[model samples]
Target chain A: MLQNVPTRQTIEAAHMLIAPYIHRTPVLTSAFLNNLSGTNLYFKPENLQKIGAFKARGGLNAILSLTKEQLRNGVTTHSSGNHAQAIAFAAAKVGAKAYIVMPENSPQVKISAVKDYGAEIIFCMNTPEERERNVQEVIARTGATFIHPFNNYEVIAGQATAAAELISDAGVRLDAIFAPVGGGGLLSGTGLSAHYFSPGTRVYAGEPEGAADAVLSFRSGKIERAPYVKTIADGLLTYLGDKTLPLIREHVADIFTVSDTEIIAAMQYLWERMKLVVEPSGAVALAALLKNREAFTGKNVGIILSGGNVDLARLPFGKEV
Target chain B: MLQNVPTRQTIEAAHMLIAPYIHRTPVLTSAFLNNLSGTNLYFKPENLQKIGAFKARGGLNAILSLTKEQLRNGVTTHSSGNHAQAIAFAAAKVGAKAYIVMPENSPQVKISAVKDYGAEIIFCMNTPEERERNVQEVIARTGATFIHPFNNYEVIAGQATAAAELISDAGVRLDAIFAPVGGGGLLSGTGLSAHYFSPGTRVYAGEPEGAADAVLSFRSGKIERAPYVKTIADGLLTYLGDKTLPLIREHVADIFTVSDTEIIAAMQYLWERMKLVVEPSGAVALAALLKNREAFTGKNVGIILSGGNVDLARLPFGKEV
Candidate 1:
């Protein structure tokens, strides 16, 4: 299943194909944050990307890679977060219909975002089995191609473009690059890009402590799954894919887990100090860096802020920062 | 009183002097906002400026222009909002002591910001008269130079740099530019820049209806003070200065007043859709644009987001947005 991992060439090709569809989101740096962390940090703010996440790169790339026949049949995906909106937005852009499967318990904001992108919503029970079954039912009915959120080679290749841009834009070889890990799409792509674009740069993964399967898998030399998912960073609840695990093992240097409290604290800090509206999952990488400041001290570090599709009504830190 | 208003050349000189001290904040545009307002909007995000407000530009320029003897004597200002923080931060940067006079009723957050920048706080009664009296007393006692928040020519010239950059960076001649009128510092500066940099561009001022003195003054052709200020946009509570009024009369095309509800709604919209953490004052220009969208329809409009220094604990829209 992992025989053909995405290479630098594939990632470069994806960058060219998806360049017109996505925004080259700004790279921000804060002197205050740098002084506090004792490291020179550059932030790639994908929260400003179309669909408010780096997932837009993957979704558009995958949909565009499809043949005419596949496009005519349309596309299907199961996501309750940014990916649903990403696929929906990408499908709408290419004039292809999208069938999105989401849990009934998903927030109205997420539902409205998907609908606003001209996607058809299919509600399912709050379980992986139910979501997959509903997705299959939709795919069977419409003869649509299933665009996996992270596992597909095209998706991984597309996500790598962010790192490619970051390395080229920063114009400095980073000591390490940190990204939050969920399905491992962003991490694997970042790892591959760092390995190829800046060979001296190390790739680090930040995962929620509640859902530390990636860390366990890295230590055990095999894939592992979380017993139960309970984290404020809801985007990191998914398990890693076979396609992404191989790349992670080959290129990723370390995996760090941060508590939900730390993630929320980082999110608050960003909102108050940096004036950036980052979601919980988006702050996980920064949380990891802050928690282990000594390891990154005096080094030039790069961080990918994954997304900013937060539910304003249910902020984790209650009413105020 | 308005004998020597800041000219375009002075503004340009101020830009050069303060270029090393300030951040050339990014210009952001949103397709969603463009679709909603039916106008091509270019946002100059000064909310991301050094002191989290465009006030930093004015403060730094004024301090940098001071003679050695004046710098040795220190600087003084009476402001309970962004200007206080700006003066404090700028003074610290130039190694000058800052004597800040603030109302006793000022928020703790604002107080802390001034303190963090190494300013000495002098408390006064909540009324503007009392605040001014206290500032005079401090100036007399310390022989400190009084840095009027928006009335000074150097301060106005400093603020003009924002619009100068906007015109040059947008690379397009705007049909009009909008900015919140808080004592008319930013508005006058923007008007001057638009007049010189983009000659065809018109300048508009946005003022809160609750504190609509600027609008009344614009209509009456004389400086009119608000009888009693009561607006969510606390930053716009002051009356226009003698220096700023003449510039506004010469260059400003229109002044629009927006209700508090509209301002809060625009703030929420920016936070929810654009993922920008703009304060109520920062959203006033946008509120004016959104309320009267037809006036700006089908044209390229530039808006200055003045600041992002709000008390998160006392948000107007509450926790839910």
Candidate 2:
């Protein structure tokens, strides 16, 4: 059951499991950007990955890692959107039933995508407790295995595969890597990769101002939770999980908080210059670089664009229903 | 003066001027899409090109084609946004001064980017005649070479080079290719490349219903003037220039029209499903495919994703500024 998983081994196994299903999305280095930031900037384009995000890698890896009996039992999860879609897609590919618990407030575009994949949708109030309870109920009713959205060793190890791919593809020793922190799955995975592949490399978590629990946690050297998150970056609203917070603290170099305005501006820059439509959460790493130019300047900075599963209608100010 | 004018030789020559300055963006093929459409689909990702559009090729080519004496005198252009920014970026790279005339109605994000690259900006009421007159005045005052945004052979030829790169990169013999038609710069170039490289490949121009002058003209077999354009696709609102229209007629296989709603829906699909942030104009070809799925079903189809430069704050509809 992978109950006593060593972080490094699980991550490595995840790379092998998901390699065939997930895209090895490109890492682009621009001379123009290097000149602008005085840094050798490497942009890992998870925006171009299948299902439009890095979460697909983890979701697929976790699904593939399941035993044949568990596959027949199906899987259930709760997410705002991206992770739900990823799990739904991955589960469907393996011919396993997927039960997705999403907030009623989730965008129709996301809901539609999840439904299109034939996942059973369970809508609940937009609260963590409500989502958790609904997921538990679904699991109990359907005899579906509960897949922790971002707090499981399997998920974190799966997410870490993105970093392993980046390090292998770029073939360069990076000074540091910046990743957006939500439930800390991505950060935890990235931190572990930096620990194993490039131990000397620093790992920084990019958090939105309104959802700075990760940053606060890093500063205090303890896990902290946000009362509620209110940010343009919908994906960064997740509170950290027990499985991720410890690994994040042990391996993460630091965390940087950026304003919503900075995230929007970074999104704009990527769209106009890089020809990418990265969501605000996906752009937070670049936002951190742009917001704190002095700190990231002239370094060999690796920025992981997390996801691009944004509701276009709600863009600019998040007003679309 | 580019005295040789709009000839195949002239367009071929522009390739040299812009080759070093712009990216030869890659083409992505999807077996899944091809099977669904009953046609092979090849996406020319000019969205991945420099300046996030095909304008970079034409813009850089026009600026670089300038004689040493002309460069010493500087360059001037009038555009709503993309062309102005393209010229500004190209001029900055070549150590030449840029004077750009833009409409007061141009998006602030576009203006900001142009200004950031150190261009001189002149604002005027948006009308084809007014913009041209203002550009002439700027040229007269500064003795700067006038780099016509669309009409010039240099720009058209430069735009053609993008198709050249695409054909070379994808290495697939396509039965037909689709590109958005506005000023016809892209169409002219794409037509020329098909004429030169893949003679059997038919070039189809896609335009918005709100701004479909090119389709009308192509059908009538003449240069039809557009009195006005009121479409969500800001870039495709341009009237056909005298120089580009003739080339389009000679080389184009057909012109297809799509609605603003279609363009928006296609943009949403590309961003959410394909994970690319294609602008309304860029989405036109994909829109054409989605709308007329029956015609393209099970055929080899090539589409130019012209650009990805949308400001999330100013998404054509739904998004509130």
**Model 2 agreement with the true structure over A1-321: per-residue lDDT tens digits:** 335544677778888888877767777765556776778888898877777889888788888989999999899999866898889989989999999999998877788879978999999999879998998899788889888778877788889988877777676789888899998999989998989988888998889989988887776766787645689898888778777877888889888888888888788667656767689999999888766768766678898999887766666753211
How many clashes in each candidate?
0, 9
DockQ of each: 0.54, 0.39
Cα-based lDDT for every prediction: 0.89, 0.81
lDDT of 1 at B32: 83
Which docking class does model 1 fall in? Answer: medium
Interface RMSD for each predicted structure: 2.7, 4.9
